[model samples]
Target chain A: MESLVNPYVSVDCVLLGFDGEQLNALVVRQSGNNGEDVAGIYKLPGSLINLDENLDEAAQRVLKQFTGLSQVNMLQFKAFGGPDRLKNPEDSVWLVRFYNLNHHIDRIVTIGYTTLLRIDRKMRKLEGGYEAQWMPISELPRLAFDHSAIVDEALKAVRAKATLDVTLLFDLLPNKFTAAQLRNVMEVVLGITLDVKNFHKKLAQMPYVVPLEEKEDGVNHRAARYYKFKKLKNKHI
Target chain B: MESLVNPYVSVDCVLLGFDGEQLNALVVRQSGNNGEDVAGIYKLPGSLINLDENLDEAAQRVLKQFTGLSQVNMLQFKAFGGPDRLKNPEDSVWLVRFYNLNHHIDRIVTIGYTTLLRIDRKMRKLEGGYEAQWMPISELPRLAFDHSAIVDEALKAVRAKATLDVTLLFDLLPNKFTAAQLRNVMEVVLGITLDVKNFHKKLAQMPYVVPLEEKEDGVNHRAARYYKFKKLKNKHI
Candidate 1:
């Protein structure tokens, strides 16, 4: 089995995006033997590593191929390996069809890389026929193999980083956003509603996240003050 | 070369311990052909993974072999790989003899795991002939291969975890300790002098780390009150 596979190393990308209202994941629909979409199940964008490239390079390649974007801020979060990780009956069946792995080669040790991207015009303008779909993280179905666990760990990493690095929020938000919009994204990630006044007060204390003198326009109700995050001289304390 | 070598995954353990005052790292001395200790150079305990074992199992195996202890709390921190990681001229020369790698295969990707052990009676009672040494992390000299970078990353993870998990300090200290002692450990780990009054005030707020009715005995000055950490229902918030 070892002789048959090039190298058992693979990379999975948990590409997270912010869509104003909810946090989303870029998952691809699985394809069957006839190249038809398998309708129900989806998986993270991933691929076996080429022997020529390193782990980071392989991760970047997979991210680019799936999202049609380069220079994504991907982080190598963890490596997942277990004897039966790939041999789960359903997962192996898919592997046999898609990857053509021999029955004996039933395990692959995959590195997990995660990145957050804004749901901007380029993301919305993805080419036709691409099998990728933006699924809200709150409503993600069971993913292939151990990818569900990978996404869980990536979310943990992001949440931990958010408290220390303000730039993560900036990357996920629009150039100018109201304080409520900022708090909503954090609430979505944390799965808990924060006290609006307290949350805004905390944001106000930050040297970054500068408030604009102007108020939001084109809204039905009263206008709200806008804010933009400024780059920190040092990202972490 | 691929056919000649086992699966290319390796595990390096950054075994750390605290000896009351300073933080120390477990580094093994590499010996040359004639059984002479290679003068000042040292490395973390590491080995290639067995075909049958997963990454965590491989890490445990290596940690046990080097430390002669079990039930070590090990965490997989990172995976480091590049085309030239193992191809350093001096490092390759040493690997050629020590690991007996096939001359053709010069690169191996390694996963890094870190474990913190209490430097108590058992640790002090190890047999005299062990090649491993507990060198203070601050005073550590340059290590072999890319191990120094691994140690740096492990320290970063530990420091980050310490801020969130007070139980980590319990693992490094005795069953009962003084507030000053606790503050000293945190100071060493963070490399800063914490305000004694403020530090103790914050600790007082935590339900855990309960103050004990006992006090330090036989000290020159007034004895300080001792404290014990209570097990939390859940460690992480």
Candidate 2:
């Protein structure tokens, strides 16, 4: 049987992982000719969707194939279908060689999907027969085929979602975390440096961030209080 | 010259309008055989994107062609690509006749775009040689294809966006709006009845909603104070 993939539509996954310090995005390097250097040609893990799978299924499959992680909650953020998306000769060449296409594919509307993962919790082993790594978002080199713009949009979407859904923040943190840790995650995600005093005041206003009875066990400085995310039935904002 | 349309990808728009009292969505009726009663069948304004235009352009074109509106800010929220999207015989027959397809089109992934409009402000004249009207969201009939789910998702997306960006709410309101009007918009979008006192307290804390030196005139009931939206330099949440 022939492969039943839709060449005009694809899905890309921006798998963001936080390692308690900085945010990183999982990217796969496009292999070059036998020994040629293609270090600068990294792109988001993506593929054209199969005829039988839905979009969400394709996103999940892409995430699993690239990162060797499954069951991660992914959000479909945007669809990128610019006519000039494949205008770059390098990108056109890569697509033809990568997918072994007999004919030229001038356009492909790719749906961008994103998900947040705890880097410390989930152990990542690159799969899908590609050279993949977690590159810190700040240090991401020039990506292939408008992928940098896709990553930028993913970051914006995650920030917008985190603002409305407090539970999303906890996904990047431990089960019980100190105020500073929570603040660190917010600062990284929001791309802003917040004042400690004001952050605590704002955190206090969030009734869902309930304080636990326990405090930090061991630390060089003053031990801080630990809090856990509590989901309220009628929580707004 | 052959048409440069890409049959595998399309754009669907959810044009939501607020009439100060209720929310409505613009839907186009698929005409039936020579004056046949196709009142029960309604679908969102959509079309397969042309190879020359991008996704956003396609969405704008769909909105303009269906409702005679242009330059509307439409946000791409989700992509619907289920294999069974066109499994309905009625939908398949309509698609074949409408697009004049020579071969079977088993799948066409649609990008969902949405925007809010003030029903009383914008004069809508249906175009694109189709019958169209604004249907109350509360009384929407069973839509064709997966549009019902798409509309539901659009509403959820708009509500999520409204919770984060106060400016989006202002789009549905006039330049100067009363407190009740704002609350009513929120109640309809959120699908919740908020307490008047609590809502007032919450509004008071928002620094962006600036009070104007104006009041409603020529009203049967007590005149209400007017307020306007102010974009803050560093607003969060």
Using DockQ as the measure, the top candidate is 2
* Each prediction's fraction of true contacts recovered: 0.27, 0.49
Where does candidate 1 stray beyond 4 Å? A1-7, A31-40, A89-106, A127-130, A164-167, A196-203, A234-237, B1-7, B31-40, B89-104, B127-130, B196-207, B220-222, B234-237
Runs in model 2 deviating more than 4 A are A1-7, A32-40, A121-129, A174-180, A196-237, B1-7, B32-40, B121-129, B175-179, B196-237
C-alpha lDDT of all candidate models, in order: 0.77, 0.80
The superposed Cα distance between candidate 2 and the true structure at residue B229, in angstroms, equals 5.4
Tell me the lDDT of model 2 at B104.
69
Query: Residue B235 lDDT in model 2?
Result: 31
Candidate 2 per-residue lDDT, tens place, B1-237, comes to: 021122378889998988788898988887554534444689998887875788899888888887677887888888998788988878877765666565667788999999988776343544235677888899999999999999999999888877667667767777788889999998998777878988778789878798889999999999889998886553321
Error of 2 at A168 (Å): 1.2
RMSD of 2: 5.5
Clashing pairs in 2: none
Per-residue lDDT of candidate 1, residues A51-135 (tens digit):
5678888888998898787876677888887665775676667766666544544567788898888888888665244578888
Q: The CA-based lDDT of model 1 is what?
A: 0.77
